[model samples]
Target: MKTLLKNGLMLDEQSKKLVKRDILIDGEIIAKIASEIEDEEAMQIEVAEKLITPGFIDLHVHLREPGFEQKETIETGTYAAARGGFTTVACMPNTRPPIDSVPIVEEILEKAEEAGYARVLPIGAITVRQLGQELTDMEALKKAGVVAVSDDGVGVQSSKMMKEAMRKAYALGLPVVAHCEDNSLAKGGCVHDGEFAKRYGLQGIPSEAESIHVARDILLAEDIGVHYHVCHISSEQSVRLVREAKARGQKVTAEVTPHHLLLCDEDIPEPNPMFKMNPPLRSKKDREALIQGLKDGTIDVIATDHAPHTLLEKQQGMERAPFGIVGLETAFPLLYTNLVRTGELTLAELIEKMTRKPAELFGLPYGVLAEGKVADMTVIDLESERPIDPSAFKSKGRNTPFAGTYVYGWPVMTFYKGVKTWDQADIFVTFEE
Candidate 1:
């Protein structure tokens, strides 16, 4: 069966305008997009006044399968992603056994296929077991079907080892997605080393911890000419370095999370773990710099480092609890409300960060609603306002600080490969494949 979406305004990224268009999806491919696409056999659905864009892609996400099922599973995580309007997510390799070997990577792909929602591209570990002492076989990992190589939870500590890994990754034509951190400088600090930390008498994690590694990795990438990507950039200096590297025409890219752009160290009301994350939220100045970075093209993508920790793990207080918070369910609405609605970023700019930029950076065949492209799309309700309720989240990790915040631009329907994967307003008309 064919599906025809009518009366939807499609975003024109180049002109920064929304043009009214109709889409006709045939099987798994988008067959046509024009002012009025008529197909007698198509099941037509009127998406009047709604915005239709390419489905979102989150480059950094944690599904927590094969090891930490209690925290999150691939099925639940992807469900949360689809609810957030994402049709593709690149899951981080920090599972129980970690996605280091071919078997583990294969397992993730198989499970995601069985789950049947968003496409899950497994990120293979840069080092075996993510120990960082010895490098994993990049060739084998790439052949096993990995989007990239990363040791995301922690940085590759040994400079020599990292250089070798980058060399190997370059040879395999894979990007090295780094979690930039110098543990020696970080010194076990939980929150940002700024006024908030000093006022609360909490140990601070200095900005250099992240930047030092960022600088080091950038140099390594420049020397090796590999596609080096910085993960969840939070520091001002890190942004500056990436900007300078890009200015020099080096192969480097960086991503910023919605939480870091919207919240700062001062926003932490109390000593709560929800506000705690690795490369902890910095001062207002840092947040401003991150926004500016996004505006000026220093930040190439917006990835929700959607790390999900169990409630018990998060309830251990700011200092004792593990670092991380859920983001898949709240990222778009939070950014759309706070950033786009406030005039900090245009809807096209924000959508580009979440869509085309990630796809272009990773060389994935997504993030476009053109003819002959995969029919991965989402219809958004840009008019309705709704409060975020964590209890309503499909993810097991109900750990977020955005609860009770009213926001607009809710995703009402999501289609992945022409299949209705998620529908909130009963608008999805199923078409036989």
Candidate 2:
């Protein structure tokens, strides 16, 4: 099958400019790209006022499949991803059985293939059952098609265990994506240890809980020369550590979430569980630092830590409810409106972080918009505006804090592997006249 995408504005990475071009897709690969291409026999899509680019990639996400299917299934998760303009995502292994074994990884892959929306890559748990005790056969996990290993929801507390995991992962050529938190310092706290927590008399999770572990993992990775990636970075000190680590040429990379860049503990408004997360929304100062880190090249990627839970689970209230918010559907609009339109980041810069940087860090080949590359792309309408609504989300998780906020730049369509996976704008038709 052949389809022509006509008159779309695309970023030419080598030239560092946006150029208008026509893209031709033959089967599952981008066949050609030129200033203009006409094929009457092929179906065509007019993207006159839209921006076409490589599909966005999320390095951290939780599909909640293989165990927490009630929260989110692979089908629902990938549907949400495609609607959110992502073509590929790596899911965290915090499911019921946990993705620590080869069988679980295979199960996820099979489910994703059956779902057939965005490409789903499984991240295996670093520890067996994520118990932080025994390692989960790193060699076997790699062979089972896991791109990386991480115990995302909980931190691996044992220093010796983490060091050994890093060593083994390095030997097997996989990145150690760490959820940095010193459990002892964390103390079962739910909200950031800041003004809100103090005002409400709630137990606060200190910044040290996350930073201490960030420091430890960076040190461990430095000694072993393993590629270490920090997940959901929310603290100022952690950003400083990552900045210094990069300065010293350590193989370390970090990602910031849209919520962290946009919200702080002070913005919680109430004691709602929707506002809570693992690393927790931090102080205003930490939020500012996270933005600055993205501006100055300290943060490499912008990922949606799109964890989903049932409405019942979220309605359980702050103290007892789960720590997460669904983000896949709102990430781009929130960031584009607040960051790009506000002059904090250019459109090209934002797209690069969401697309190219994550792919390069993870060594995947799905984020470039060049000829002969896989035809994974997203077409976005930057001129239209809409309000954030979780009820309309494709995922089962309707737990988001951006419910009534107005935003611009919604994705109009998404293509994965040359197939139209999701479409919001009625813009495709057979070529005529």
| Local accuracy by lDDT, each model | 0.92, 0.92
What tens-digit string does per-residue lDDT give for candidate 1 at 83-171?
89999999999998999999999999999999888999999999988998888988998999998999999899999999999999998
lDDT of 2 by residue, 176-248 (tens): 9999999888966989999999999889999999999999999999999999999999999999999999999
Q: What is the Cα-based lDDT of residue 56 in candidate 1? A: 97
Clashes of each: 0, 0
List clashing residue pairs in candidate 1.
Answer: none
- Candidate 2 — which pairs collide? none
Which residue runs of candidate 2 sit more than 4 Å off their true CA positions? 425-433
Top candidate (lDDT)? 2
TM-score (C-alpha, index-matched) for candidate 2: 0.97
